[model samples]
Target chain A: MAGVDMDMQILIVDDYKTMLRIIRNLLKQLGFNNVDEATDGAQALQKLRDKPYQLVISDWNMEPMSGLQLLKEVRTDTKLKDLPFVMITAESKSENVVAAKQAGVTNYIVKPFNAATLKNKLQAVLGAF
Target chain B: MTDQAETNGHEQRLEALVSRYKDIDPDDLVNIVEGIINTAQGDLSSVNLKVYGEIEALSRYIHSARQEIASLRPDEITDEHIPAAGEELEAIVGATEQATNSIMESVEAIEKEAETLPPEVAQRLTDSVTQVYEACGFQDITGQRITKVIHCLTHIEEKVNALLETFGEPGERSARERKANETSGAADAELMNGPQSSEDAISQDDIDALLASFD
Candidate 1:
């Protein structure tokens, strides 16, 4: 896999603590050691602004600011606009995909994905991994 | 003899009139009877009209209350949300099971290979594998929590449906209709399907095709 360096900084955002833990474990399995977490989109956006991350994986449903809203914010910000963003949601609707695409998401993954799916999605966004 | 008989008859007639005069005050009795009848008629009509009006108002209030309760079908909390959450939980369980199995298989494979390795290295690998096994126990706890959540949601749905049946308006949407009308949001009407059944949701291939079309 030639996609992302294992040492690259990654930000994962989800409202559910279990989900966060699950994703963190999956990333660990994938050998991605440098990872941070935010409980909601607002906190995620704050983290994005404060730090430099190679990737952002966010859940769609969250309080205060949803993943879509956060995507829009990331796309609009001058410094963060180029950051590769992936939306991880249980929502499988075509409209959601289109909206995320329109908002400039790097990729999309439905929830309950395994290490392989995450790896493939990361590869698609970053390079051949 | 004829004069005595005439006197006896007149005296009997006078006695009969005087007997009728017992329980005196005929004028007052006439007034009492008239008053009772008049009051009964007047009061009954007035009271009956007032009661009828009150009943009409109560009916209207009930109708309004029913309409309000029917409208309380929340936008956020849908019957779909519960099932979607369940599906997610199921997926998690399946994934965890698969991972656990894979880890066990790997450990067994490693055990066969470990015979060539030194004692300390073999022990370390075994301990690491054991930790992986321990971590997989999270699935059991998560599954229990998800089951509890599903039960609570099911209970809520039953109560809501019952309330709707008892108080909802006739033309209000059925569960089917409400589901059909459910939109994800204005921004992503097409993409708002949370979790779909096998039939309704498109596959990853379909998503790829859709994305390809946009290009």
Candidate 2:
């Protein structure tokens, strides 16, 4: 879903650098130019504070810190609060989903999702669809 | 706990059946049907009472999901009936994660209990764990390697269980297979990421020489 002229900064957080690159390229293809990358939740937090990002696309599982943890941290922090956050995961676990929802994730996308599904989930999170 | 050897053997038979399904008889269909019926009768909802129980669990999940959504203040919250899907997902993912955790726990328990046994037994347990780990697709991020490993491991696990039943020890082949896997895994990682140091890259013969570790 594209509005006439509004740019949004999207932060892609994943432990796998390859996954981050893939998501970054995918978002760029979708016409979102302002994009950033982080390897884990902690790094994501640092980046979030260093600059403002309109959206966050994160993986559910990672060492040191997790996507859910990042979501909670983002929601709890006053400045970064209300940022549109999405959880992308291979884990379809109910508790994981519940946990993500509880942490204020704007939406959840299961792994192996296509570009269409990614767009749909983003729209759902942004309330555009 | 159920006998791992028995389970492994059962899985191997399942694998053989899946791979050679074209050869199975029309009569075997009756047994397969019976198995499905039995599982559904025991594990699936056979009556309203069981269905109600499942719905109750689902309702709780839905309620929580709704509360979370309301707080996010989206542009418009479409009633996607997330709880219904959430309920189904909870059951499926919860069961899988529980099963995996249970198996890992059993392996850990066996390892701990076997500590007092001979060194050979301990080695076997370690190898068994390694086999299961690889089979479960721990190393490969692509998920294909894990799928193939799981298929093979399921067969091997069944064989290992049977060997344990007969010999009072895990199967030797499982450990040997695990060792082979480890060697190949290291080689695979090297190939994908390249060697840790340039000095290790002697020649094509050098790569062949390194493979001796697996052998």
Candidate 3:
């Protein structure tokens, strides 16, 4: 596979600070250094509007707003509609996957994923990493 | 001679009267009455004793149950203890995040410094750094599980508070307390399920299969 751009600005969103850090570290291992963090989808949306992020990796469950809700908002917005969105969730229920698919998520990754799984999902979404 | 004969006849009638009355013994009649009275008194006393014992046992049981309920006050379970535990968990998560960030930063620095080293040695160093990064991933899953635990504790606290309100005191119930009581039964089933086990949760492959069906 060809090399992935290490400078692609990515946003990692989760309610847990530890989750955000772990994702940030994982992205760093995959050679993506320009990563921003958000505690939830609401904050992630704010950051998304304020800055240009090539990719969004977000947890599914959160207070006030969820990753799926954020995805819907992104899909509805004319400017950010085509942005790549990857959902990170602990649930792999069929209904949840279908909902995410209908919401136009680029890809889905389950929790407790290793660097290899992350790489594969990134490759699938962003192409040849 | 005629007077003597009449006296003898009267005497014979008197003897007959005496013989008929001989079958009725006053001593025996008195003994039978006394025995019946004694048996009735014994039975009555035994019944009364048993009833008193049962009443005493029931009273003791009720007293014990009341004490148990009193011990289950909101202060014991719902007070600062649960919230404090949640705060402690939050602090641990925060510390873990900080430590993980430090490790990542150090790894990055090491990776940068490994540029001038032998190719194999640099690759090994990079691999080791990657291992550290992967190890830090535990914090995320652990944090997620702990969040669930905190949520459970919060639910328990709500229930304890509601119990205290309903059974605690008269006229001390607030609107919030009433609302808590009303909504206590309405907890989300998903949230209440806590952390799912491997058997309970579907795998990524299952998700992929479902997504594939969408196509």
**Candidates, ranked, TM-score:** 3, 1, 2
- Reference contacts preserved by each model: 0.21, 0.00, 0.42
> What is candidate 1's DockQ?
0.16
Candidates by lDDT, descending order: 3, 1, 2
Candidate with better lDDT, 1 vs 3: 3
Residue-wise C-alpha lDDT for candidate 1, range B1-215, written one tens digit per residue:
47789879966865675579886565566577678878764455556979978999999998998767757754324456655765777787677656665665675567557657898997687556545544554553454445445555656655566666666433242332222124234554333345555676666666666666777
Q: Which stretches of candidate 2 lie over 4 Å from their true place?
A: A1-6, A127-129, B1-215
Q: Between prediction 2 and prediction 3, which has the larger DockQ?
A: 3
> Local distance difference test, per candidate?
0.69, 0.59, 0.74
Clashing pairs in 3: none
Q: Which candidate's lDDT is highest? A: 3
- As for TM-score, the candidate ahead, 1 or 2, is 1
> Between the candidate structures 1 and 3, which one is better when assessed by TM-score?
3
Interface RMSD of each: 6.7, 19.9, 4.2
Q: Which stretches of model 3 miss by more than 4 angstroms?
A: A1-7, B1-67, B170-195
lDDT of 3 by residue, B59-99 (tens): 89877765677776556555567878989998887787787
- The C-alpha local distance difference test score for the whole of candidate 3 amounts to 0.74
